[model samples]
Target: MENEQKTYRIDGFSCANCAKTFEKNVKNIKSVENAEVNFGASKITITGDATVQQIEKAGAFEKLKVVDKNQPKPEKQSFFKKHREVLISGLFMLLGFALIIINDGQNAITTGTFLISIIIGGYQMFWTGINNLSKLRFDMKTLMTIAVIGAALIGEWPEAAVVVVLFAVSESLERYSMEKARASIQSLMEIAPNTAVIKTPAGNKELPVEDVRIGDIMIIKPGDKLSMDGVIQSGSTNINQAAITGEALPAPKSAGDDVFAGTLNQSGYLEVEVTKNNEDTTLAKIIQLVEEAQQERAPAQHFVDQFAKYYTPAIMVAALLVAIIPPLLFGASWATWVYQGLAVLVVGCPCALVISTPIAIVSAIGNAANRGVLIKGGVYLETIGQSRTIAFDKTGTLTEGHPHVTDFMTYGDYDREAVLALSAALESKSEHPLAASILDFTESEDVEYSTIHIDDFKAETGKGITGTIDCKIYSIGKPENFDDADAYQSEGKTVMIIKENNTVIGLFAVIDPLRESSKAAIEKLHKMGSRTAMLTGDNEKTAGAIAGTLGIDTVYAGLMPEDKLDAIKNMQSDHKVTMVGDGINDAPALATADIGIAMGKGTDTALETADVALMGNDISQLPFTVNLSKRTLRIIKANITFSLVIKLIALLLVIPGWLTLWIAILSDIGATLIVALNGMRLLRVKE
Candidate 1:
């Protein structure tokens, strides 16, 4: 039989080392085939037949609790309850200090109190560390355990007790920081209500969203939040889609309009037909993707992991040398040099360095998700921040996508309405991109063209269409066949001419207008030292006009899908390039670019293929995303530098025989706290 796969949310993980330890222990289980832990997200995946009890036992060193991925989270405990062991140990250590002051020296009572404190506070650490030491798995816990035991052997009972209590407190603080970073995804999961008022065949009934099936009708009243992704079946209303799109305005919606789960419906009742199940909703997918993204390691993170793999063992050897070298060869005191060596081991813990990159990535990704930007992983985030040029697909990306009839002019004996009606009559039978534009214009003018029947309709690819109305032959095609056609084409409009028996009657000028945010977005990118380029299948004249208006640095028009891909390749030779498109038509180029960004309203192919997604479908978010990525990179770099610098300073103290257990633990704790806090600043970034 094949191994079953299961994922669970894990609690009580304190540090990256502990997470690794838990993962290793689980993989050692007899029935387990493989196991992996996402420390940043505090979740684990296992492929085995191991029971929940078995998994929990594997993580018993940290007292970890495991629950099903879909289960409700357990309630939080009070501070005192959560830190009971640490608090009790601290009390005992304080009592031991008082007894020493009263007795004027170390006595049986003081020694016993300190011993009790060490056992209580360091129980888990010692258990895991001792096991690791036996296996020769040198992690932070192993190093700390060696240091504490050495301190006790040297008759430094008070210092050992202090080390245990301080280490426990530091671990708690690290755990709290991780939880704070993970809260962003947790908040997103709570956006939509679990139960919805679904209209059944018999009557309306409220049920869990999981029980709601596709095609079921949901009755949503004014001021109520939508519980599923669906199309409105009856009535009209304005929906605030801020939760999904991050747009401030409420979009007016009516029958036939699609609505997403977690949107607020304001004004008018609605009967919505569910289009997707609870797990398949757009909001749910966002949460899932964000959680998965946290597991991906950035380049800096990989480097740090590789560095730490050898760094700890190297520190262990160095400490061992410092402990014996001076006393054996240089005539130094064994007790003094050994004490310095133990302090070196404590200072060498890589807690801060191990967490530097992941915390920043998690916080920045979460903040971007909240602002309607989805960065697929840390690599893409880093690439986007470093990209010097961005290439955009013109249609649907920089424009409104659908063309509109901007100008209508009559020639010979035809009037504007007559020409529009005739064009609409013939276009109603055609399947061209511009067909809807003529039909819409005819309806707006009340031209009554739909009643006319077109006969023998013939469509000529890349040219025009021909048909008969009232037994009269009529044709609509490119205006280039007629005189004065250059006038409209010069202005970058697509001109379609109507003719009767080869004589031109009238013409319609259409253009796909630029998006309101396009020019401003392009300008913002330029200001940030990024070059902009436009790619389109449109004519050179039209593409140039649009590019000029937006101040884009380059334009590549009249290109096929393959041509766009080639263009991206060319741009990559000199600079890193990002391709932005609607995701479907631009798949080849999007895949070929250094980074691909898709519009949120684009097809499913775009959402899955692109490296990043602008969920608001607003180009303005592009600048904000770029800014956030750059800031996150800076923070990660700063954290790594600060952590190493602090560790280096603490190690140098051993040269003058000034290093002590108190200073070493304080340095480690201070570095961990500083890096965690600095990384968390990413969560405050806003658009």
Candidate 2:
């Protein structure tokens, strides 16, 4: 049998500690090689000989059900069916309290009613405690059951009933908090419709998204949400991609342009040729990646996990000493000390501390995805918050990547047409961005150009290209390859030198305009105290001029692809660097930097290689992303501090026997609710 890796969705998997317990138990199984439980996503991924039966068995103690990822989870039981026992137990507790108030502690009926509440509310905890105690597994259920039984043994029936009711309420609130955190991710799934209108052999027909095939033509009317990824075959319209890319303005789309599923078509009728099925759509990929990002552990989350592992056991020992030492050694009153110890047990649960980091991370990642920012994981999100320096590629990053021909002059006996005709023919053979500008210029000028069969075509990165255009070899490159080229360089233009038979023929000056938002974004980064630099293959004059216009702090010009990587690595020694680019040449530097941010409109290689992707290729979102990261970190720290301080204060009360059952449970459960709400603040952060 071959080893296989499978992922299963888990239902009823809210407790963070229970997730760890399930992972540990699954790893201990003989056939399993490794197991990882993602609590935020409620999933378990395992690689080895593991079976669904084995996975279910590991989670049986927590009532967690393991099922296939694609399988519809068993329908959630109705509220009445699921919480019937909880309702009955609460009624019993109410009756018990009323009886005590009516009888004034003298009637047998009061004691009996209180006993009934204890039996109804405390039975499940006691059962779970016995099973766990037999296996030597200590958990919250075990601690609670022990505390309740000890209080009942010392003749404090009312206090025991109070403990049972409060613990049940605490569990309910914890489940509610987890469900609220998961709601943001679930909202993403509801954005796209389940059906689409596709053109069939007979006519236009409505079909389920799963039945829609690649190459099928989809008709999208104005106000309809797109149901599949495809390229426009005809018509023009504006698309609202705010759901996917977070670009606030409606982007105009024309013939042959790509549109993503779940985006709204705002104007004109569009006929699209489908390129991807429902599962492979960009919207689907974003949802899947966002869910996984929430599961990835950050450093603070890991620390809390380690802390809980020891914290629970140490608190159990402390409660035991409080109960036994005062009664046996100091001759303290047994009932009073025992009740205080039971209160300590209620306050010691690690519920708030464990969930503090993950809830904040999940909220931040989901929010970023909605705005068209894709943050891969919590670690990368946190790293971007700490980055001290950011290096940017000049073309397509700081400036509009498209360039236009400014001035062209023939140096030899050749006229403008003869030189440009040969230049356009040679440039047509290449796919570089500059080649497109040359082709556009020739078409605009109506130069009668003829295609020539070029032999031995070659290219030099950061320089230019060469090919055979006529009987003589022709070369098109930078101004440095020719003599007396200082005029164009001094004008801050990228001058392409044309040479044939070792003689200079012509010089073409071109300039790519800077992006409108570059200066504002750079100024914002500066205000945030982050240094910025520009790395480019353009000559020093051109690169320096563009950098100066945008107020960039440093410029590294005349660089090859490898040279850009070296520049990033050199900067890494002094400060954490963020490389931003949108081309194949920018891939190395993007990967070499401490954090890589890629423009959304950049090449697919650059997008995949980058740590963070700006879907609209807008520089304005850069400062917003950095500010969001910083805010997420601050919120996480606040949650952790608040949880610890509340617990510290509750624990101090136990020293003077001042704590009561209600106050102790409130301390633990209240902190949990407050921290959860605090972490959710990141979801409302605006881009």
Q: What's the count of clashing pairs in each model shown?
A: 0, 2
TM-score of each: 0.91, 0.91
User: Top model by lDDT, which number?
Assistant: 1
Compared with the true structure, what per-residue lDDT tens digits does model 2 show for residues 548-657? 78899999999988999999989999778888888356877888888899888522443466788887778888998898888888988898888889988998998888
lDDT of 1 by residue, 374-404 (tens): 8888888888989999999987788877988
**Which ten residues in a row are the worst by lDDT in model 1?**
600-609
Instruction: Tell me the RMSD of model 2 versus the true structure.
Output: 3.1
The CA root-mean-square deviation of candidate 1, after full C-alpha superposition on the true structure, stands at: 3.2
Candidate 1 residue 464 Cα shift, in angstroms, is 8.2
